[model samples]
Target: MKAAEPPVPGLRQPGERPAPGPADGVSVPGVATPSSTGSTPSPAGAGIRGKRNAGALLPYLLIAPAFVAIAAVFVWPLIKTVIMSFQDVGRRELWTGDPAPWVGFEQFTNILGDGEFWDVVWRTLLFMVACVVATMGIGLFLAQAMQRMTNWVRLALTGALVAAWSLPLLVATSIFRWFADSDYGVVNMVLTKYLGLDFRGHNWWLDPKQGFLMIGAVVVWGAIPFVAITLYAALTQVPKELEEAAALDGAGAAGVFRYVTWPVIKPVFQMVATLSVIWDFNVFGQVFLMRGNKPEPEYNLLGLYSYEKAFESNSFSQGAAISLITVLLLSGVAVYYLRQLLKIGEVE
Candidate 1:
């Protein structure tokens, strides 16, 4: 309603201010001006921000292929195994083009109802616990000893440990089998001739309970080197000054280890223990090769039991169910350890 304002020089419109020029030393609210070099100033931090964003995505891109491969190789098979467990997958359906009929949880129920299965489960648990305890105990002792040994002695011990660790599972099993031979084994000979215990011609693998102990011994022997080396490596990271200080404070060897060294290496020990539990619990090659073509029911671990059910007995569904149970058990241990590690991280 008011009279129109007079046109203003350098104004785009009547209400607008004069457009800023190079000599004016004024800036537009949302526009960038050229610098003294005559090049336009870039949007604030645009190049740096772009580089930061690319860097953030680089790690994910690098790992994507590995993730894809794992998903295809391991995850896919696991999913199929789980699906097969819920279906009736026997020789007919496996060979024929027939669809496997779903019998949800029937195989699991059958396994649960079988007394023999329960017995095997108990034995497997006992075997796993025994091997874990024995392996950890012997490994800890050897690790501590190695830390104090002279260089030459340490070198020899390390070589022996590496040899044991490097032995393949099947090869180690064969070696132990030879050692347990009733007629010619060195073990029986040592007991009979050297120790005067009359263990000659004792068929160690005949009795199921005794066979479990024998095979467990083999597994423990093979497992010890890894655990020992890992613990020793962790021990080396603990500062010698701390141990000396503890010793200076009137702590004996045991007290120094318990107070000063244990805390630093406990995490490594726990990690090794968890791995031992997993490996021991799933051990199949040793027991299978030890029994040699005809594995006894008594010596059947969860791993061997599952194998026998699927391949030998042709009970694929039941075998898959057993494998799932084993997976669940191992997953529980893994989850517990993961939570513990997270707690330690938070505390740190």
Candidate 2:
């Protein structure tokens, strides 16, 4: 420019730009330079990401068929039953192709208004409570006893429980019926002859109170195996170290159980109790078979009453309403237990 300034070191000449070097293409160390053709970087990570996503979804996809089958088989039938409860479904509508008229809540209202319905509800509630209490008590006792038993004894007890649990409902009911026979039954013989009691030739099912008790006994007996097995499994999960620590701290056996063991198994105990209540409340086969489908007024539970109303009395909608009520009641128990289970999960 003015007489051309002396050439300075590291300075470019006028109208001249710096040349590209090996360091010019490198924005950071260890990073590759852009391609000569100016193409974008290959998405190599995308394929790996896609593979991971597929793996994550595979378990859900595998279980989808099972969920679909259950929805089709059980859920569909249950929904149909609920819809039929709101309709006036009779023999013609059930057997023939006649359309069932929509009755709304008429069946529900009628059943609610009936004195007999309330009676059966009370009886069922009482029986369910009794059976649940008995089953839980016996089951807990057996579980604790099994925990302390020798291997052979535990094996024998477990085998007996499994065998009892495997017995068919009808078979167990029949066995109970034989045991309760008035003339030559084992119960009366044990009471009158062995125990010197005055129960000989006593017809156990003749009275409503006694009949309910007898049915409850059978329910408790059958339910104990399931409850005991479940409780035992839960008990196995509890560390023996906790019990020992509690004992070393001068806690008695009861104190140790109440403080150390109960907390660990409380969720399982609640679940077992809830299930027992539902099973006892909805028991049909045992009561129906034991009473020969002609249960006395005193012995009529909701299940038996519903069957009688639908089949014998031919009031299909009303029977369905009763069954729906039973379902709702059982659902309440299920919901409560599910909440408890969720709480346990959250705590864990």
Candidate 3:
């Protein structure tokens, strides 16, 4: 057959006619080219592979900075703290004590057995619940009111809320502390003069019930603004058509809010409540500054207890132990709720 046609490159004899010629878009006698898409397929395959690799690396690239920062700041410190928690700060030879000596879990055991620690734990739990419930209730009401306001009023109200949120945490704490001051505070004066109550000269921090209530009030006030703003944004996303349809069906105001409004805005409520719980549990500066970081058995939360252990008593290990416990507790809450939050839009 014409001297056997010298076998075509990358192909069998002439009957095979090679696979295809990409440029001609047909089978050829010698050239072996991909038939699909009338082009050489290898380059296209390489391009697709490169695109897949980039896609796989994109997420990591986005988060790389955060990971690096965390490792440098938080993760490293956390590891060091955990290590220090296992050491005894007291047994060291003071100036030459090598920082700390290994003491196992003695610090944790001591904290666990301390009655004050347990008391603080109970207070923190109760405080967290009260603050979350109060914040959610007020926030939902404010959000609904915001939704009904005119554009000017909405803008004004939103600005006011943002001011409250943007106020420095320490500044807010100072303002509330001054307001709650028994002798000079305007609040006590109002109570004593207007309400005819003997709130003046009262050490509110000395009384567990009143102290906890005062802290909760300040927390709820500070937190409601944030929650309201968040919920208001979510409320805007709710369809007006759905609300109108409900109204057309003779649904009352209460019915529309209870059914149509609440469900649509429920995600924001859940998110705010979850965050509120964490903030409430970690409340320190407000309560501490109010009492000057002094430990009052009645008002002490776990945070305050940890502060006392670290600074007041110089028990670094105990403080670290309490911190570890609080972190674990908060982490558990985050893990539980984050799973719920990630599933927010899944349900119809």
Candidate 4:
């Protein structure tokens, strides 16, 4: 065979491959070129580095002021309240600028041992239950109804819900109080005129049960909007095909809801129910306002009892102790709900 021509330097022969350089790119047939987009750091790297640094620091910077404010506004007072709960803080210590005498757990002991405190606890719990049940019941009903409404009707209903939910606590309290007014109230006017139940000049607050019933009505009214809106949103997540399939499988409305609907919205329902419990358990404003900012002993919830102990009776230590107990009770409630949620999650 004739001698093959010597392969030319710096030029690739036919079917010849180029060599890779030690640097970050492949050498071409005639030249080597460095890669700009390789792993090697570049000027752009400084920008990326800066961005990463900023990304790490930005959250801290944004939250720093909020953390300081919370520490000042809430944490500091909470600490002081905790300290006061262990001491003998009263009007004497408050006004005299003197150190509060340490009573250790005496304040807690006094509060726990009081028969009236138990009464307040039972009453508060019962009211909380009533409001939560009514709120959840009506809210679920409204949400179920919304699914059957026309778009315009649903929109109008949603607007109304928003209006109800947007009412300030003070405004709602005032409205309910006006409704329950003894003489000129609309509720009494309607009952006496239409139903002729002889509710003229009746004081709902005279009986604790009746007073709590009215208070619960106000609480449930305000709360239903939130629960309904939330559950309505949750209900939107349910698969239409699944519901249709369930319906086709000889399931009725209740069966479809129980099998297809409930599982989907159960988490949101649980969350709303728990929130209602917390909100109703700590109810203060409606009760306080309905009774003209001077709720009697019969209407005393934990909040009212604590206020009565601390400010009204000038027993700051006792009030702080009661407040602490309320916190513990709420904590227990939260834990119980959490466990239930977890259990349901496992079961489902």
Candidate 5:
């Protein structure tokens, strides 16, 4: 090629530089354009600078009042009770606004060694067990029957149960006391007139054994509603397909329940029994309303015992000790049942 004939006038050879100031219509690098005006900040970059914590801790801060309320009402009293259980105070010290005496474990020892305390313990245990068993048994039967009924019948039964549950404990106690009253109660009338039995009803509240039985009966009546509702909910959850499958296999109603329903509901039964035990152990209203101030021959339970020790006998330390024992018993029951409830669903 002609040794590179000079490039054309306005065009340069390949890779050659443009002319001095400008190429075609474009300006040279030395030239400058006007800077942009009225431009906004980048949305993403602006967001980073304007970001705040969004008050992440505001929810917990709002709930602080509730936590304080619970601690002030429940936790503080529980702590005070525990502390008082260990101290000793004479009647004068307890009543005359004097300081409590520090007796350490003496109150605990006294409670353990006391005959009446032990008797109350025995009675409490017996009553709790009996009430729990009777409540659960009747509750289960009623729950099963109600679960199989029409919606109308089920609603009626539920309404009745709710009525029983909603009845004030005092009201129930009054009604039952009137019914069992030896003088003019309807219960004795029915037994004497309708049944025509030789057994003339005596003063149920006057005897401790009879009082315990009456209290248990009243408690069972009130408690069955709760236990029955709990079991009914559990029964409703039993797999309908499994029940149908059992029926298809020529299994009778009892057989199907025994094999399929019982297994599924067994855990619920344990839960109800444990809860009822705790409730029965803490029963004070029924016994207190029926039998007051009397000891072995009339009323015996930890609650009544504590009340008598503190108010009747002026043994504040002993009362606190008994109350603490009751607390421990209830706590143990709660822990046991919590563990059971945790393991309940794992079986299936």
Candidate 6:
């Protein structure tokens, strides 16, 4: 080897490999080195792993606060209500420190046996259906009309909708009551003066049909803004390219909506409709205010009926039972929304 090239310092000798530098990764005996294994740096791989773990936990972290709040505000109360529903609670039991005596299923049994409860149930369902139909129909019409509006007009319309939606339930109920009040109401005055139908002193609540019509009108008016705003937003997101293509294919307005728009907005539509059903099914304020708080037996919806039973009639257990039944009845809608949420989660 020619005397090993005079053993040059910091240089490779004959048949002797140069050692790895720190940048290339110095190998420890009997240990796996990153360079030797042709793998990334441990810290880099560890950083990626940490990021993945964080991403996995992010959704739960975001929901944790809300879950805690709902548990305290709704879940605890719900559990207490369930417990109360089984007890024969009254003034004595409520005022006393002692627990109320158990009535088992007696409260539920009595309410089930009462024909008036069934009538209230039927009436609630009817009102909910009518309100949902009218709300959805008018809201959908308004949303569709908005798509064709000029930018300024759309902005003005959106502002109006927001203002309407911002109104408190009591305020909206009061406005509707004033509009349809039996004495000196705008509706009566207008009908008497302009239409000449002589509806000056009509008592709407005398006929349940007419009373529900007015109540349903108020509900629809309040509900429309939310639905219209949601649908309009959904409509805006629909692919203009697809709509144009459908039009080019000789599709009419209805056909374009059926083929291109409906699929895009169906989930939103279903959610809004379900919400309307829940709200109108448990409607109390509008009915209560419209009938001046002393709602007749015929004027009671599920919520008002429950309140009347609990406070006015002092049938606490029965009211609790009715409330529980109401929850059970609407459980289907809850399940539907839950599935929708899960489906959305899966998509994400």
Worst 10 residues of 6 by lDDT: 1-10
| Candidate 5 ranges beyond 4 A from true positions | 1-56, 91-97, 199-201, 292-297, 341-348
Residue 58 in candidate 5, Cα distance off native in Å: 3.9
lDDT by residue (1-348, candidate 5, tens digit) is: 557566577767788875655335455566632332234668987776666433666788899999999999999988877777888776777579788878799889988888877887888898888888899889999999997799999999999999999999888988887888888877778888899864465677666677778778889999999999999999998999999999999999999999999998888888888889889899988877755424453476889888888878887778888998998878888998998878985765
TM-score of model 3 (CA atoms): 0.79
Question: Which residue ranges in model 4 land beyond 4 Å of their true spot?
Answer: 1-51, 335-348
Candidate 3 local accuracy as lDDT?
A: 0.82
Deviation in Å, model 6, residue 127 alpha carbon: 0.3
Off by over 4 Å in 3: 1-62, 91-99, 198-200, 345-348
Candidate 2 lDDT by residue in tens digits, 38-145? 755358877888889999999999999999999999899788878878998888889996889998988898999999999999988988888889999999999999
TM-scores for every predicted model:
0.84, 0.83, 0.79, 0.83, 0.80, 0.83
In candidate 3, what are the lDDT values of residues 164-264, reduced to their tens digit? 98887678878878887878988889989999998878767666788778788878888988899889888988899999999999999999988998888
RMSD, each candidate, Å? 7.7, 6.4, 6.8, 5.4, 7.9, 4.9
Flag clash pairs in model 6. none
* Each model's lDDT: 0.88, 0.87, 0.82, 0.90, 0.83, 0.88
Q: Indicate the residue-level lDDT of 309 in model 6.
A: 92
Clashing pairs in 1: none
Query: Which lDDT tens digits does candidate 6 get at residues 41-125?
Result: 5898999999999999999999999999999999998998898899999978877757898989989989999999999999999
Model 6 score (lDDT): 0.88
